[model samples]
Target: MSQSDAARWEARYQAGTAAYAAQPSAFVLDWLPRLPRGRALDVACGLGATAIALAEAGFDVTAVDIAPTALARARTEAERRGVTVDWQCADLSDLRLPPAQYDLIVNIHYVNRDLTAQFAEALRPGGHVLFEQHLRWPTPVDGPGSDHFRLRPGELRHLLWQLDILHYAEGPFDGRDGERLALARAVGLKHH
Candidate 1:
């Protein structure tokens, strides 16, 4: 993406840090106990919820998002929580991370199907990726209006074909602001 993409997200995030939940997704909290502590990456980590949580859990963390405002807020919150996170601002919509550089990768409530292949490639052996995103459904919800932005049925499973899926679920979910969203959540482990 170009500077236009950053400007667009910057405009959205100008609305303030309340754009998403203040806490990490339930999926992240649930799987924290199962994941190994190591260097981690949080792609499009708006407001730093997941990134902060990972840091608090002792993972050397790097978080990236397009909006500087959001990253600012996230940095503040992470500091308030007394956790260290390397917050970076970038347009990861066309994300490409270093190969086998992280032990864990996290993506919450964001989609970049184009990045799935690189997701697995970015993880070291025995590493994991915890992902959750809105899915196409017949109901109005709190996510992208376009089907292209949401995962199709069974798409999450297929996207992580290079890894072993440790957990997966897709259905109506309670999201921020009591919105009923069809979400797909998955935990995939890379086994070399």
Candidate 2:
């Protein structure tokens, strides 16, 4: 992401258009008990819902986002919830992660197909990746205009093909915001 893009996201956060659920999404919560508790990374962690939830669930967490304002808010919430998280601000477009460093990785909403490959590199042999995003089906109603930002049918599965896809779904889902959307979700586990 460019400085201009960062500035745009910063402005969005400042304008309060970046609001996200304070609680972690149900999909994420569902996989909590099934995942190993260890080093975790929350990619594009907007309000730190997943990050904080992981912390509370006894996982050491590091979260990243592009906007400082959003990170600040996430930090405050984490502290308020009595959880500690290492938060970093970085462009997801140019994201890189240390090899075999995480036991769990959660990415919700935000889409950066390029980063999917890195998830495998960042996870331990038994680590997992949980991802969900609006799909480009019947056209997006209120989302990025570019198909590049939306997942095409089976694209996510193809992206995580290297990993064992333990869970996968694609269809209309009632979003936490009460909007119905075509969505795709993947939960991949690394066995190597």
Candidate 3:
């Protein structure tokens, strides 16, 4: 991530309660029952909602993010929720994910196409990945202003092609704030 981008996110998180909603992504919650309870990674884990949910679900969870302010808020949320989560403040762009170390990886509302291969390699055999991100659309919507962060149509399917796709969908949906958004969601399982 660029220094400017990091600054932008830090400002966004610090400006208001927009980033730390104390609620897990709806996509993660939907697939919670199907996911295995084991070592898990929550990439770009803003406010640790998904990490807390995973920890509550009995997974050993590690949450990573670039913003210290975000991680600090996440830590408070984790403490309040009475769940233990290993929190790391590091730029995902500079970090190397451990290979075959996680049973599941959850990434929501963040986009870094370069991390797709790392995500696959970081998961244990038969491990799962649950990902959701805003998609580029003809109409404007509330999300990252840059096209660089938005996925093109069918792009996510191609990104995770190496994994066994359990579920995949791309279309308009209600966002966290109830606004219509073009989003892509998928669940993939690495082959054992």
Candidate 4:
């Protein structure tokens, strides 16, 4: 994405017309048992749903997003939900992150293939990475947005093959016009 695209997302958040929900994603709730009781990072955390959820689930969470408006909304929701999360406004593409610090790293509904290796490096020994995103589907009509942001078939699982894969799947799922969801979840342990 170009500079203009990032600015557009900021402008959209600033508009405040899009209703940001205060609840967490269902996938996160479903796999709550898999998360470790330690520090976690929520990447591209729009509105802080996943971040807040992690905190409530007893993990120290750092929520990072590019849009200040979105971060503001997330902060408000975290307070309303009576949980604490460290909110950071920074572009992950350029931000320097600590490696091997977190016990869990989460990415939901966001796609940045270039960061796959970086994410793996950021995990501590026995850390798990949970990822979910929309993917390109074989449909007659084209969906919204650029093809660059959408995942191809089996791309997510393939990207993390070097890690210990716990679960993986790609297919159309319910909610929001039957989105094509791809999940590549795994645990990676550092050498002791």
Which lDDT tens digits does candidate 2 get at residues 1-192?
789988998998899886764568689999899887899999988878889999999999999999999899999999998999999999998877889999999998888877887888888999999998878988456656777778988889998988999999998887677866788999999996
- Encode model 1's per-residue lDDT on 68-145: one tens digit a residue: 888998999988889899999877866678899999999887777777778889999999999998899986777778
Give the Å error, residue 94, model 4.
1.1
Q: What is the lDDT of residue 130 in candidate 1?
A: 95
RMSD of each: 1.6, 1.5, 1.3, 2.7
lDDT for model 2, on a 0 to 1 scale? 0.87
Which residue pairs collide in model 3, if any?
A: none
- Between candidates 1 and 4, which one is better according to lDDT? 1
Best by lDDT: 3
Candidate 3 per-residue lDDT over residues 22-61, each given as its tens digit: 6798889999998778999999998888899999999999
C-alpha local distance difference test of each model: 0.87, 0.87, 0.88, 0.74
**Model 2 clash pairs?**
none
Report the candidate with higher lDDT, 1 versus 3.
3
Q: Say which prediction, candidate 1 or candidate 3, comes out ahead on TM-score.
A: 3
> Which candidate's TM-score is highest?
3
